[model samples]
Target: MASKPGILTEWPWTRLGSFKYVVLAPWAIHSTYSYLVKDTTQRDLSNFLIFPMLLSRVLHNQIWISVSRYRTAKGNNRIVDKSIEFEQVDRETNWDDQIILSGLLFYLASMYLENGSHLPLWRTDAVIWTILLHTAVIHPFAEHIAYFALFSIPMLSTVFMKNISIISMAGYLTYIDLMNNMGHCNFEHIPKWLFSTFPPLKYLMYTPSYHSLHHTQFRTNYSLFMPFYDYVYGTMDKSSDSLYENSLTRKEEVPDVVHLTHLTTPESIYHLRIGFAHLASEPHKSKWYLWLMWPVTLWSMMVTWIYGRTFTAERNVFKHLKLQTWAIPKYNIQYYMKWQTESINRMIEGAILAASDKGVKVLSLGLLNQEEGLNSSGELFLRKHPQLKVKLVDGSSLAVAIVLNSIPKTSQVVLRGKLSKIACSIALALCQGGVKVYTMREDEHKKLKAMVSNEAGHNLILSQYGTPKIWLVGDGLSEDEQKKAPKGTLFIPFSKFPPKKDRKDCLYNSTPAMLTPKHLENVDSCENWLPRRVMSAWRIAGILHAMEEWNMHECGNMMFGIEKIWKASLENGFRPLTTSVDPKPN
Candidate 1:
């Protein structure tokens, strides 16, 4: 070993730390020994001495780098810089490359050596297995030793066991390479020992056919060591499955040595089917196991059903969901019963239809749960008239009076609490610009009407039966109570209201009544068998008519109250409008 002058030269690390240099001394000594052994005439001593160490080092580098990168990539769900390099360089360090290079060097040197006739062996399999044994024993343990020398063993215990099998296999293949490849050799003719061992050795190394496949078309042809294992395990790809019928090139092929390059749906499903087959083929079949596993099977079935319906069925599920209730009109008794059961919905339907007929662009508001309304009643209305532009805003946004105050600037609808301020502000702004303001609401019709009191205000009208606070502050009122109100009060009825028992103070009048067309008509007439408040009566009638036409009973009566207030002011010679003191700025 010391006869090599280059190897015996002073170490590069002599100027560095003693402890670190001491560690590298063994490596220097080993390198010298490897150099000497390469030229040694004794094949057994050379192969036994150098091949194991070199193979182990190569495998150590490969497995450590591969697994380190795998862990790093898996942690972040992405491959970082070092991981990418590791993945690229991992398969390139096999025995064949090094062996070919070394063989060429040795062959060149042999021309000048004593009694050198020719090379012994050049087969790639012989080179690989020799390297394999080196890799198996040396790589993993060397990696652990190297890392531990630098860091601590406890820190790398996780990595120690990750690639042990690959290392062991490499060691086994390396031993086979020694016994078979270097053990028997002839330059010009087949060796007698090789013929004796060739059949059994076929199980241990790449065969002639496999070696050809690896060299020429390695992308799809990879069956290392034992081709049968590759076949049985379904790793070998014959490339029979074609993505394109006319192409024989295995159109989308992954590199033979690397498994990560290509991914296909059929390949994935094939693997899944293989897994399922394996599960089904279990030897110890038990009914109890099947019974316990039924829930998982059922869940998988449901998932598959959903997935199939989503992709394979080629239908828009959302659209289907929306139109489910409006099923193809059935001309049967069942259809008639459905129509009868949905009579109330039919009224809203009629209103929508009428709005369409009258050329009014109708849109539904206040319905937040689209699945509930749109899938049923609303969907029918929409499909019958597809041009309608309906929208669903969050109901919770308008739930409370205070929450209504903080509404984003984009909100257009006037919240219950902000109504008075918004009405006053709009009226004030528009009146200044010579634009008339017509503010409307439920019970606070009177208060909104009072906003018209501004001199510059063109025509401000609030059309509800009660005060601003009463409309929001109280629970709610009934149809009769709204109509029998005093002069300024207009009966603005709602489709439904909380019962009087629930909100007693919200009741607008002494008499009890429900919301019906007949009751609304009486409210429109404004003839409650009492002395005539002439302007109040006409204003109430006008309010009632508007509400009936627009379907805003509460809103109409509130406007009636405003009209009464305005007319009263006109009769008294146009008094300056006085608005109620609004609460603190929201």
Candidate 2:
């Protein structure tokens, strides 16, 4: 939205939401009906293609949006080097409005333009030209002509051109969209040597840096695709060439810490920073409307199977320290599959080695990537590459600290579900801290009692008897068991993924997390199920590991001092969440 929004600034079909595509459905159906029922000579190919072409434009713009957001976040060759806050995201969310407007205009132009139904062809009929040029060597020549129509002679609108073939029109429209997206993407991919080879090309084609000035300065460099008009009107920005040169010379960013994570669910794809802005700004959860996109979601799952490499999900800077987040292609369930163990380990190993080569001080394995069953909490990578420079962190120390701090000192805690390293550590710490730790499972109680001294072990009770209000839960906590808890019982989770909330009267908390300091920049979105500006303890631990300049790796059987980490976190300005989280249960 602009500073002062006015009439027509928003699309009339805005209230229609996602179903706004229905506005073009009648034209599409009528065009198809006419093409199929009419005689061969009377069939209008241009009119029939209007709907599909408009849809293609929508998809093209979407590709640019995703790619631009991803690239800018990575901070490689960025033109403007400015932050894209939630306001920028909301303002740009309606980028497809132009495509919708053009589709309606295309319909009206077909009725008023001369020979609208039977326009002249380039060399032959559209059908033959499309086939011969696509199958022969003339496709490149036709694209050059389209570029001329787009860059040199910008007045030629495909919707109004009476002397254009359908094939040439498609090419022209594609080239125009490609250039338009490139100019506004805020990423510099054009090389400086290209201008040196052909100096006149600088004025003919616009670069991202040139357009970035138009956005920032707002008074000059107003040309759309070409800078020729700016040059003619003497409105060309003075720093265009220098900015382009600087952008080309810029290098990719190097970070002090990297958190390696994976997809939590199939629907989490939409909650990525590179995905929908509205969804990313909030905690990740399933949406009812997402079921309508099941086909696309399924396709994305299939694509991830083959996308074996890691990708940058986010980048943030706090004070003098730089941080980054990289995501493995696998999902949460995939990490549990026995067959995927080897492949998953290979990906994690590769990412660790890559981060080491890039001079990253610490690499943290987040979520299921540190599952003991998968890689022994990242010990396999250490064994394979013992000489690696980057320290691997599982963040178990801080995770347990958060769980211990969350339990109310007055309430007895009922420890439930599958016992793991962190669960055992939390139980041990609570016993030492004089907090009663009760277990529903007899085997878990015996295992925990045997680990501590007789004095501390007295606090571990083996029974489902007491009605403890504070429940320290882990994965595999059944819904039936949760139904047994008292009303208003608070369930604090130690596991990475939270448990299901089966009882309405019972309260649940998000997995171990802490409130981030105001110094963290570009934190517009929540970290998975955690609340806004509240980061996962594991993530904050990695950042603290780098900031404290700790050289030791915290993976395998190693456990850092919990009290020390807690004090360091508080001293570094990462506060505990004052409010309890109650997100929709998984």
Candidate 3:
């Protein structure tokens, strides 16, 4: 809300007509770009002009207004009208459109810069450095802020489809030209080529794919330069179907700060739960001290808000951050699966109990260690009942192992696919022996959902034995991770879990779940426990001596740092590596 005099509030179209006053863009940019490619006599001035215009627009009121709207919505002014129904649109367009715009803008701006002509060695070097710094530091930060502001408005589109052809066409053409200019013909680092490749692309602008999802689904996809934007802002801002369609409509009012909600689809909720857990693990001040740290708190909050808002405002900011250029080669989904599974084991039984309405069989994969079962005691109780059957699989293949262990003593099995296929081979062998076919994995639930929409019959093929239901049987794993389990699988996450018994269930069952040599060491080693006291004595002596040296100069607030160090020493279980005061000669 800017209250400009003579503004047309009721008639939107009357205000839109004001765009006619905008001067036509200069023709020199196109001429320069065309002339550079076709004629050597023409100076390469495309980048020098284009980049400035884009930057200028960023400084303009329209962009700032968009940024303010985003901040207001994300901050204290956000309103949620649950009655507003919107169709599912691809939010991914936010990323796609941003990259396209940045590419055009960057080239135009670069042309106007001094880099357009060859000069003396030192002068040329200075110009190149200037361009690099401008492209990297100034451009990425500014773009990230602006784009965040623009995308913060969570408006769902009437059309559910994406303009992929436009995106793909623009992406390939622009990226190829960009890659060529960066001095590399391919996607690798080589000499001067290394700087110009993917990293620069990501540093300069986001890829089209990233923003397209934002447009398609407005609420969840707010980040500009990095996916880290949402994490920093305390919002689970990522691409999701619910945010694009049903999320805002179902909720009656928008929150000042995004509230933790169980119904925020599966992915967003998982991020919140797991992220909060991680935050809890980190060292933080007591509630009272934290509340007292008003300046620091305000600074942190403002930074998050500004960072998130910038990305939403400037769609091309993602490209400027070099998100598209850098390749995360080893982003394995399976690695995450294994990690989550292990963490879940700490409270598996409880998760199972939470998920099941009646006693049910649990076919645990690998080893169902005692601690894991104990952590998930509710599931354990259900297992003890006569109606429930608990199975354990100890096979090489994870999928095969979990299934084999879960099957009841006697059950019929069906087999499909060729004999050579792993699923088929295991199914046939197990079927002959009257064992039911089953699939197992951390993502079993997600697979089941995808199975629903797949018209190719592949989904039905996987679901022949039915989707595996997951009672997390543990508190550590996130709801999203649980949901991602095979489709038709049920998630028994601790938070927002269905009620059981009269007492409320604990969100985290942190009852000394893991027992190993580490736990034994904790109990047996007096030396480990004594180190904190020894360290505290040393720290106190050191501070006393330092204060004396400074003649009481360090007395005010200086002791706080030492106090923090002392507390950290105790919390981390610090200990001396050697038993002796001094090492003996070897």
TM-score of each: 0.15, 0.87, 0.19
User: Model 3, which residues run further than 4 Å from truth?
Assistant: 1-78, 81-92, 112-377, 380-586
Off by over 4 Å in 2: 1-4, 29-43, 111-161, 288-299, 580-586
Q: Lowest-lDDT window of 10 residues in candidate 2?
A: 135-144
lDDT of 3 by residue, 404-504 (tens): 33333434322222121123323444544534434333243344324333332222223423333322232234343333334333222121112122212
lDDT of 2 by residue, 448-548 (tens): 98899999998888876547877889989887788778777888899988888788887888799998898888776668988778888888889989889
- Model 1 weakest 10-residue run by lDDT: 254-263
lDDT tens string, model 1, 416-468? 22242223433343345444333335545446545555575334444433232
Question: Alpha carbon lDDT of residue 567, candidate 3?
Answer: 38
Runs in model 1 lying further than 4 Å from the true structure: 1-343, 346-351, 354-380, 388-495, 501-586
